[model samples]
Target: MTSIALIEAAAQRLAGPARRTPLLSSPFLDEIAGRRVLVKPECLQHTGSFKFRGGWSAVSALDPEVRARGVIAFSSGNHAQGVAAAAKGHGVPSVIIMPSDAPQLKIANTRALGAEVVLYDRANEDRDALGAKLAGERGLTLIKPFDEPQVIAGQGTTGLEIAEQAAEEGVSRADVLVCCGGGGLTSGIALALEAKAPGLRARPVEPEGFDDVARSLAAGLIQRNPRLSGSICDAIITPQPGDITFPIMQRLCGPGLAVSEEEALRAMALAFLRLKIVIEPGGAVALAAALFRPEAVEGDAVIAVASGGNVDAGMFCEALERFGG
Candidate 1:
C-alpha cells in the first residue's frame, strides 16, 4: 500500500507542476442521481487528465543524475501524454511505447509534447516486453503507469483535494466513485481517504466487461480481464488489476461497481449537457455508476471522479447524438 506520507511528499512535488482540478456540482445531476453529487473534473487537469500528477511525481522523484538519463513509459493515451509532458517539463527525454491502434489524437499529442512514440500491435506484441527492451537499450527508466509507488502516491493528490474540497461544501461523508483501470487511481484515492476522511468510502467503477477490479474485490484476490479489446472505454481496458494496486484497493475500497457501454455514453452525454464538461467514455464510468447504480452508493452525497476528457471529435459527436442531447 502507498503510505499517506509518501502521497503527501508527492503532493509537495506536484504543487508546482499539476493543476488542482475543480470539484463541480449541478442541480440537474443531483436530481438524476437522487443525491448531492460532487464531481472532480480531472479532465481539466494538465495533460488533460490526472495522469500528469503521477508523471510529474515519478519524474521529479528521480535522482538528478538519473533524471538526465530520461524515462520510458507504456500507455494507451492518457499516461503517454502525462509522461511526455512531465519529461518535457524536467528537460529530460521520454519514449512512449503505445499501441498502433491507440487514439490518434493521443499519439499526436504525445509527439507534440516531444516524446519519441513507438507503435506496437496490441494483439500480437507484448507492450511490457517492448517497453522493457526499449528502456534497457536506451538506458531509460521505465515508469509503469500504475504499479509504481510514486505514481500511486502522486494520484492520491486528487483524493486529498477531494477530501478538502468536499469539506468546504459541508460534505464530510460521501461515497467516492473513482474511474479505475489497473486500480492505481482507485487505490491511491482510497488510501488518501483512509487517512484524510475516514467517513468517505472509496469504490472502484469499471466498464461491465472489464470489471476485473470489481471481481477481484469480491474474490479477495487479483483478477485479470477475460478480454481486453471489446469495450469502447479504451482509455481503460487494462488486462488486470496491478499487483501493487490490488493490495491497496483490497485494504481500502468497498465493493466495486460496473457500468455498461451505453451507460458510459449516457454519462458522457449527460456530463456535456448538464455539467457543461466533456468527459471521455472511460472517464465517465464513475459518473455512470453514480448515476445508474444508485444502490451502490449509500450516502446522501456522492463524489464521482471524472478522470479524463480526451476523446475524438467524431466520438464526442456520436455520444451526443446517440446517447443524449
Candidate 2:
C-alpha cells in the first residue's frame, strides 16, 4: 500500500514529465450505459500506458549512485516501455525481460526506448527468475512492476489527478472502474480515492477466466488465476494479485467485476469508434464493465480508466472490424 504523502511527492516529481490525461465523455456511451461516463485515456500517456508513472517514480527516486548501477525489470510491454523510457531519461541503463509472445509493437518500443530486451517463453520460462539472475549478476536494481511502494505511490498520482479533474467537471462522486491485473493500479488508486475523494469508489475490473482479484474479494483471501496465458487482455494477465497491493484493494475497493473477452474486445472497438481513442483489450475492461454491467455500479456517473493503448496494429484493426458487430 502507498501512503498519501508518497503519492503527493510522486505527483510533484511527475508534474513536469507525466501528462494529465483528459477525462473524456461521450453522449453515445452515456445513453448505452444509462449514466454519465467519464473516460481517463491513459492510452494517451507517455509510453502509451499508466505504467510510466510508476516507472518514472521508481527510477527517479533512486540515489544517483544506485541509479548509476542501472535497473532491471520484468514486464510484457507497458511496464517495459515505462522502465525503459524512465531509465533513458535518467541516463541509466535498463534491461527488460519480456515474454517471447508479447506483441511485437511493445517489444520494438521497449528496445526503441534504449533498453536491452531479453525475451523468454511465456509458457515454459520464468521471467522473475531471469530478471533476478540479471539483477544479481549486474548489480542492478530490480523495479518490480506493481509490488514496489514507489511504483504504487507513483500510480496513485493518477487517482489524485482524477479526483481533482472530476471535481472541476462538477462530479463530486463516481464509481471508478479500474482494470486490475496484480492490483497495483487499482490498489494505488483506491488509496488515493480514500484520501482525496471518499465518495468516488474504486472498483477492480478483470476478464472472465482471469478474475483472481474478483474471486479474492469474494472469498476474503488472496486468490490465484488457474492459468495465465489464455486471455486476450494480456496486459492485465498476472497469475495472482500482488502481495503489497491486495490488502489495500481488499480494504478500499468494492466487489470486483469480470468481463468476457468478447466484451473487452467490443469495448475496445467502441472506444476507437466513439471516443476516437485506441485502447488495448486489457485497458478496455473497466469501460466494458461500465457499458455491459452497469447495474453493479453505484451512482449515476462512472469513471472508467482506459489504462493503455499498446496493442499491435493487426489486433487493433481486428477488434475494430470484428468486435464492433
Candidate 3:
C-alpha cells in the first residue's frame, strides 16, 4: 500500500485509542515569524508522546500467536514507554531495554505498564544486541523502536491528524516541522502530509550535535555518527536515523535543520509559559527551528509537532532559566 494509505489505516485503527491532541495557535510565535504558527500538542497524548500512536499500531498488527508470546524493544526513553503501554493495552507482555542513564520517569512509567526493564550503559553497551538476545531467549516478538514499517506507519497517524486539522481550519498548505531522532516520527509525518496535503512541505528538525538525519539527507545516503554529543533534547539524540526511515525522509521531507541546545530550551520554555503546555526538549526542537531559522519557514503557515511532554522537574526548571523566562 502507499504510505498515505498506510497512514490512513493507522489513523483509523488508532482513533479510538490515541487522543486527538489540540492544534494550538501560538500568537507569540506567529508574531515572531510573521506568519501563522500552530503547534500539534502530542505532548497531551496518552503516555505523553506521539510514540503511543506508533506503538499501538505496531502491537495491534502483531500476529495473534506473536502477541501471545509477547514482544521486546530497546529505547532511550519515549519509545520504551510507548511499547510498554501499547503492549499492556493489548494484554501482551513486553520487555524493554533502556540505557542505564535514561530518565528515571521513563523507566518508572515503563515498569508501571508491567514491562520488564533491562538497563545497559549507553556509552559502553550495545542495547540492540541485549534486546535481541532477550527476545530470542524468551520467544518474544522483537519490535524495533523506529526502523520497522509498522512503526513508521503508526507514527504517520500524527501527520494524518495534523493535515486533517489544518484543512478543517482552512489552511491549504503549510510547512510541517517535526523533531527527528531515528527518523520514524519525521518520516511518518512526511508520508502522511505528502499524501493528505500534496503541496505541504515537511521539515525534520534535529539537535545541533545530533544531526545524523540532516547529514544523511545532504549526502543522499544513510550516515552514522560514531558518537552522539550532548543535547538538552536527549530523546532525539540518536546516533543515526534508521535505514528504512532515512530513505522515506530523503524522498518526502525538505532538507533537515539542526537547532542549538539553547534554542530548544527556549522553545520548551515558551510552550510552557506562553502556550501553557508542557513540552520536552525533543518535542520543542521543531519550534526552535521555526524561531531560530525563520527564513526556512517564512511566508508559510507552519505547524510544529510538539511530540512529547515527559520531562524531569529539575530539567524543566533549568530549561526555563536557560530560556530567560
Candidate 4:
C-alpha cells in the first residue's frame, strides 16, 4: 500500500535527482477545451518521462547491498529508459527487457544509458518469467514497471508536486488527468491528490481499444484488453489494470475516460505547436481527453500529465504533418 508518508519519503529520496516538471498552459488548448487547461510536461523529465521519479525512488530506496547487485525491469519504452538511467546514475548495473516492436529510439536510449537491452516478443512471451529468470541468474533485483509499493509511492510524488503547483497556479479544484496503463501513475497520483489536494481529483485516461481501466471502473471488476499491441500509444498499453493499483483508483480516482488514437496524435501535435513540447501518443492521451473529451470532464479547469516523449522520428513527423495546424 502506498500512503502519503511513503510518497513523502520517496520525494525526499528524489529531492535533487528528479526534475520537478513544470505545469504549463496554452491559450490555444484552453480555447479548444472550452476551459483552462494546465499541462504537466513530464516529457521534460529525466529519461523523457515521469517514470524517472518512480525509477529513482525505487532504485535509490533499495538497501545499498541489494542495489549494488543491480536491477532489472520490463517496459515498452518509457519505464525501461527511466529505470536504466536511474540505475546508471546510481552506479549500478541494469538489464532492460523491452518488446521487440517498441520504438527504436527507446531501445537505443536504454542501451545508451548503459543498460543491457534484451528484446522480447510481447505477444508470445511473458516478461515476468523472463525478468525473474534474469534476476535469478544475475542476482539482480526485479523492479516491476508497476504493481509495486515502492514504485507507486515514487510515482505518487508527482501528485504531491501537482498539488503544490496547482495551488501556486490558484487551481484549487480541477480534474487531474493522468495517462493510464497498469494503473501505476494514475493510482499513485490519485492517492496523493486524495491526501494533499482533496479538491482536485485524479482521473485515468486511456486509448479507445485499450480502455480496460475505464471499463473495469465502470463494471466494478477487472477487465483485460483483447489484443496486446498495435496502437500508436504503445507506451501506455497494458493487458489490464494491476491488482494492487486498480482498487486504489477505484476508490480515490474519478471515472476513467478514454480517447481515440487519432485524438492522441492530435493532442500531440497541439502540444508541440502550442506548448512547444513533443509528447508521444500514449503520453498525449490525458491531453487528448482534456481537449477532445471536454464534456466528460468536470470543473472549469483541467490538468493533464504529458506522461512521456520517447517517440520515433517517423511517427512524430506523421503527427506534425497530419495535425500540426
Highest lDDT, which number?
A: 4
TM-score of each: 0.96, 0.96, 0.94, 0.96
Q: 43, model 4: CA deviation in Å?
A: 0.3
The lDDT per prediction is 0.91, 0.91, 0.84, 0.92
Tell me the lDDT of candidate 4.
0.92
Encode model 4's per-residue lDDT on 1-325: one tens digit a residue: 7888999999999999999999999888999999999999999999899899889989998999999999998776788888998999999999998879876776878899999999889799998899889999889998888899889998999999999999999999999999999998999999999999999999999999899999999999999999977998988999999999999999998999999999999999999899999999999999999999999999999999999998888899999999986
What lDDT tens digits, residue by residue, belong to model 2 across residues 226-314? 99887789899998898899999989999999999889989999998889999999999999999999889889899999999988888
Give the clashing residue pairs of candidate 3, or none.
none
lDDT score of residue 240 within candidate 2: 89
* Candidate 1 C-alpha lDDT tens digits along 1-325: 4799999999999987889888998999999999998999999999888999899989999998988989999886899899999999999999998889877877889999999999999799988888888888878998889999999999999999999999999998888999999988998999999999998989999999889999999999888898988788988889899999998899889899999999999999999988989999999999999998887788899999999998888888899999785
> Model 3: per-residue lDDT, tens digit, 1-325?
3377777778787978888887998678788777888889999999999889889989898888878899988876788888898999989899988778877877888899889999999788887788778888889988877888888999988888888899987887778889989988888888888878876778889887688888999999888866776667878878788888888888888888888888888898888877899898888999888777888774468888998988888888998888745
| Candidate with best TM-score | 1
Question: In model 1, which range of ten residues has the least summed lDDT?
Answer: 98-107
Off by over 4 Å in 3: 121-126
Q: Tell me how far the alpha carbon of residue 42 in candidate 2 is from the true structure, in angstroms, after superposition.
A: 0.3
State each model's C-alpha RMSD to the native: 1.4, 1.6, 1.8, 1.6
In candidate 2, clashing pairs total 0
- In model 4, where is the ten-residue run with the lowest total lDDT? 101-110
